[model samples]
Target: MGVAAPAASATPTDVAPDAVAAPPGDNLALTPPMGFNNWNSTHCRPEFNEEMVRGIADLFVESGLKDAGYEYVNLDDCWALPERDENGKLVPDPERFPSGLDALGDYIHSKGLKFGIYTSAGTKTCNPAGFPGALGHEVSDAQQFADWGVDYLKYDNCNNQGVDAVERYTAMRDALAATGRDIVYSICEWGQNQPWTWAQDVGHLWRTTGDITDTWDSVMSIFKRNVELAEYAGPGHWNDPDMLEVGNGGMTDTEYRSHFSLWAMMAAPLLIGSDLRVASEETFDILGNTEVIAVDQDPLGRQGTVVSSENGAWVLSKEMADGSRAVALFNESDTAQHVGTTAEAVGLPAADAYEMRDLWEHESYQTAGTISATVPAHGIEVFRVSPDGDWAQYPSAVEVGASAVQSEAGTTAELTTAVTNLGRTPAKSVSVDVAGPEGWTIEAGSATTSPALATDAALTTDWTVEIPPGTPGGSYDLTVTADYRSPRHQPRQDSLTVEAQVLVPPGEGTSYVSDLAFVREANGQGPVERDTNVGSVAAGDGTPITIEGTVFDKGLGTHAPSTVEIYTAGRCDVFSAQVGIDDAAGAGGGPPQRGSVTFEVWADGTRVAATGVLNGTAPAQPLTADVSGASFVELVVTDGGNGKNSDHADWADATVSCTA
Candidate 1:
């Protein structure tokens, strides 16, 4: 759900006629709201129903997440009828929300949790989940939400009919307050309207970017975009970089830990966007890390800042209430990197000998001098600093990532994890243990061994992890843990765990993939605040791809199915496709040039060829690139930063062939 915030210009309206003004000091979100949002998980799919909401709420109560500050359970888009009732009030989609929204709110409240609903500030909400927006009916909808006991409102900015963002959001703010309901207003305008510049008092949190996918690039892109805008984030008024993708399986445990740690340090809200019902244990741990939550929910409300950056490595620091500090060392490279910096570099007094506690590893140390750690590639190490000597909490100091050679079902695969000591001191008697699927036989490096792990030293742990010959192929998380003693710090023993995603492919051999094949999950257009496009698109009716209002220019380019993957395993791999603008991808849904775009073909993430800006004025053009010896080919379309107003583009007759 890497969608930008929705923003547009529109007229305003007054408050509800009969309702009283909200009570004073009704600013509900004293801190960033921690909760669950459905849009990221189910979206407008038929499965996004009341049962899902109730089950999530129940899990929140049962999973000890509520105790960890995850309170609000929000319904992002959908959940409402296409139009308002005769009384000019919003109605829940009875088919999906059988008990209605009011009953849903009551059920959530019964679990001692707050309930939130979604709406847009424009005349029309996001499509497919269509419903009249609050532009002309703000007062009425606000009153209805209050009547339903709604505690929060995620007000979006889709189909604004060209409304000024500040004015529209202000009107909705006044309307919500007039309903006499203390609703936490969340402004989602895709950061396009620069809500941070004007939304101080209008809303609690504002989106700062487009939708976020569960890819390393998405998380890293968001971190880069939102981290620099720390000046605008504080207690109630926060800069949102979209929802949580941790535990979603797209990223590794190390990456997820880094994602969660970084977001918390930025003082962003902790709204989870994963399927709670089937959330794995790893997901629960990441979501329920109250220690990290404390940093984000610190009463000071000051967002963390990047005090130092070098060679793709950075130190993000935040000041806490008790004069303590939180710091994270991030490594964004492909190899492990050691970033050495002092506590003072992260905004701490050089005179104080601060005790550092690793938030993720759950270990403590007393470091009087320089603080340093050898971080894993695309991983992070977080710590809380205090002016106290506390080494008793030191348990284990190990960071690990696993890779498997030959992960096919019938073949015996060798799974290896490199365990690195991130501690201030050396670790003795280092031993690696692995536990995998129930039926699989996993051979370890040793039952007991002594590997002295000096600070920053790496120990390779090999396991002949064999998958049952007939075991169905799928992704499996093999848990890898390191056990050792603190011969340098403490006498007590310690253990640390990491979950490695082992994927078993369908089959091996040369295979043909369609250039028309698509792989992206969500539409380039966001839901609720943008065009209502299908999650999956087809070149239907032997015409252009017309699922939803989105129209692919060439009958050959279908962006909905998935981003085409031109796999190349030989010496003569060629990828070719026709590029054009999607007639409906413009701001006004214009044809051709109105939705100007440049299509770039990436070979294994490196740009190979790009078409010049294409629009209605230009005829369809063909693009071809040699993907020889490349494992993956990707097609990316950009609006050249001109905005995807009507940028409905198409890549027709896409073909990937390896002649060798």
Candidate 2:
């Protein structure tokens, strides 16, 4: 009935409490721990008695979670008494744990699983006035758990304060090692200190952040931070972002999927923190996604990294066992955007055709050396890449339609080019260099561009740039190249031909586009758009469009909202746009419908050149905004309602148009 127990700490070396213990076997690391924790479900009152433990063990067996690779059964803090035995041995809280510690251990072992417990480096347990133990008691406690055949220890740092907190944990680690038992120590310090750099020497895994709540933002934020610690995780140690809240209330199933996907990519501990005795079927499916789990347990053990990001959308990639790569297109925006990937980014080929297996949709895509797909907002598309031919036998595919488009506000060209991968395995870091045809100089957004090609992935590289005024307009030819490092070959390069046409100084017409789509509704249903296009314009493919109408929003005196996202197809690689509004005076705090506020959206960072101003109140006249160059468009009104109420704002007559 209470939250299931948390596992034992996984570091028990004879050094300081924070010293990393020898890794627990290759077993746990092979697939982040898939068990559960008690903190999210029961908080401070999780019951860890023998009977409760047995019930959870039964659920683990019956739910087929054990068959799905879930092992360790852990207990968080609060199972100990305030006093120890005369011989400096630890004692169980008599009223809570009537059976001897050994009996509980034997029962868990009898269930064909492992058992774990919790403790703190401070003088008290998680309870401010409860049973907390310092050095001697800490060591003695580890000995007791070890003597009882515990497999893991979750060492929390609640109520412990000092400048050298890491050192304090290290002391307990040494004490545990003295017992001669191989117990995995888990450091639950809540990321107060940067544990990644040092926790490896102290425990098997360390909590990389504060506790996680069952909210979408909570899950996303934790994951965002985990990416920052990718370099510090490896075979013996992992980053623990607390535990999973998959079955807990608050977030939706899609949100949980995102949570799981991100954790797997980060190669973090897979401890579940929910009530499993009666979890829903949806929760079971999420917990049992073996394909996604495979990526997490990839033998390389290298955590996924963010190669690039705009707004909240992220491009994550991980190395696989066969020297191939797994790439993920992710959308983190509140709305939706377009998402896509190329072979070069995955380290494949630039001149040869390739093939891709979309993990999420369970489909296959073939490209003439480049690959691309559209993703929705807050959604993801995971794919496995393999080579289509010999790494050295193929020739670079022909490049096509290389061109540059520039933003009026800056000196950068939005370069669009088509390139291909010729080799077999996937390619990593496909890129292009931008310069003027001859005397013209490249400015702003233009930088080195590379396409991530997976075996036969063929896609276009879409990039943008800002051009400085007074630059002469003329015809210029630019070179586009695909640089990649495949699993079978050292590194290779290919090229494309591009012709830039900078129009004469325009003193007449202004042009642009904003594509629109219906991403979500008020039903609390997760966004219909892909996770990778929450705030971009590609929608799904790299197409162009023009805009010619006026856009307006009516803001209440106290509230205003202004944010929009564009999506292309179901993928999230090409959608992009932005919106903005004039700041109204005397606006109070709240939702957009209740008051005056600023609203705005941007496309490829151009602020959408328009004649009308963003108004906090109704537009001077009914204005129709024309959107172009986007696969889909999303609109958002900030401060739509007063903090205390909902339904304060309304949107109407919004329309979208694309290239003819």
Candidate 3:
């Protein structure tokens, strides 16, 4: 099979030849289509049948995703039959899809959701076991999809070697329009030929990078890469950074939230590629974050950009429609970090008191100078800052901080107040006033403090408040007022509020397995890596496998042999890890331009799995073998594949399956 491999284009301009007919009527994706696609979770597996799609559609309705504006449920590669019918029209795989595509589409539409299908622009589809190709029959296939009630089309570029991308994609765009159906066209040419500059006329969104494997490197790389192309994305068309890998596992909740936040800021389509039927409540909530979703679907349609970034802490700011700004403080580093930037840096009107709403925590903060936070590792803090509309006539420096400590109901809860001056002027006498809810035992703290506050300095105090046992387990807000006077001026008054939540006692749960059973080989690249945190791991392995993304502590400087080793004291059946050339280290264009790595895996000095050459463009594979009787496993990656040419390999999500 001669697959038409494509390359990504970084050039700024597109070579648009001619324009095609506009899509029928406007119900199609005006903004990047918010939907779910099945590819990241289902790799054309046999178990992915129509019932699963219907069940996912049901979940879309039940989980409030449909109401939140996620409209399409798409199936990627392998849903098609091996060949077209006598009429040369694409057909669904009868064995896997007993109800056929028409019935499936009807079922999806019956639930108020749209249905989408996938095809390739080349001679043959990418599916190793699916339909032949849709190139020559673009017209017939488009008509056939419309006939079957298709609402969206994912046009891939597999097997389209030697063919011009603009010619191919534009032809399909015209064919879809000729069919008299309003289908949202999606171009998946792996960003070859700079689709961003040209895809506006052909598709609603176009993939701007290679297929996203679930990994922190992969996700963060795409995030950083796509945000730079903000000017290219717009209202009708968007820069598709591939589908989302959320809930597919291989990542902590923090990384996934960062992923979602980054994608939202970039104006990328929010396409869930996970099993919605089995999604956890946490996953459901992340996908249905209406505030974050609003940023992605903003009517202004302006993609976000990194306004400020340093030392793995990045701030992406997006301009919203209502003159507000969406800001995300992302900590890409493995350790927690304190990141901050001026409100003006994130596009807020200068020196004005703005109301900043924490989208994730659903809280509000009023600040005049800067937006700042101490973010967790692999976590993000997103906020929407809008002018309080009561624009400060005279800018002041002092800020009264109000915060609450959450505790179980019937227990003592803590309230905290701090005074901070972000402005130049400081107050000589600083005092705080506190108020509690009705009928609650409010043991307040000292109302005033003696310490004079200076610029950028802070003073804090705490109060112990007893929450009544009969009070409901929910959040309570305490009103706080601050009275302070500048040594050179008169007393001024401003008020702020702090919120605390009372929780219910948790129930006793069954014993669970702890991560203490896993041990590192002392040279693991970073920390314990979730399978999805490293690029080479399976898309949805769900099992966290340790990975080595770097060959050296400071990064790839010298080309040396890299290895990942792990051992199990108990009985283990299998050992596995996804292997590929790491993009993070190799993208730097260091020595050895072409990455070539050959890995030989051993168990107790016995060679069990020997892989061929691995590189970046090549699809990463899971290197696994039976080590049922072995006590130790060793994976040696050598540069001998192409004689030490940037052989930075990622033994992503390495782990062993214990028989115990």
Window of ten residues with lowest summed lDDT in model 2? 541-550
Q: What are the runs in model 2 whose C-alpha is more than 4 Å off? A: 1-31, 46-49, 82-89, 93-96, 349-355, 361-372, 388-660
* Model 3, span 322-439: residue lDDT tens: 9999999888764445677777888777754676777997755555656776566688989898775643333334556655456656788777777665544556677776777886
Judged by whole-model lDDT over C-alpha atoms, candidate 2 comes out at: 0.57
Candidate 2 per-residue C-alpha lDDT over 535-591 given as tens digits, one digit per residue, 9 for 90 to 100: 111223211110112233212111123343443222222222333222222113323
| Count of residue pairs whose backbone atoms collide, per candidate | 40, 185, 4
The prediction achieving the highest TM-score against the true structure is 1
lDDT of 1 by residue, 318-375 (tens): 9998888898889876445666577777777664345788788676765544566667
Q: Rank the candidates by lDDT, best first.
A: 3, 1, 2
Each candidate structure's TM-score, on Cα atoms with residue i matched to residue i, is 0.68, 0.58, 0.66
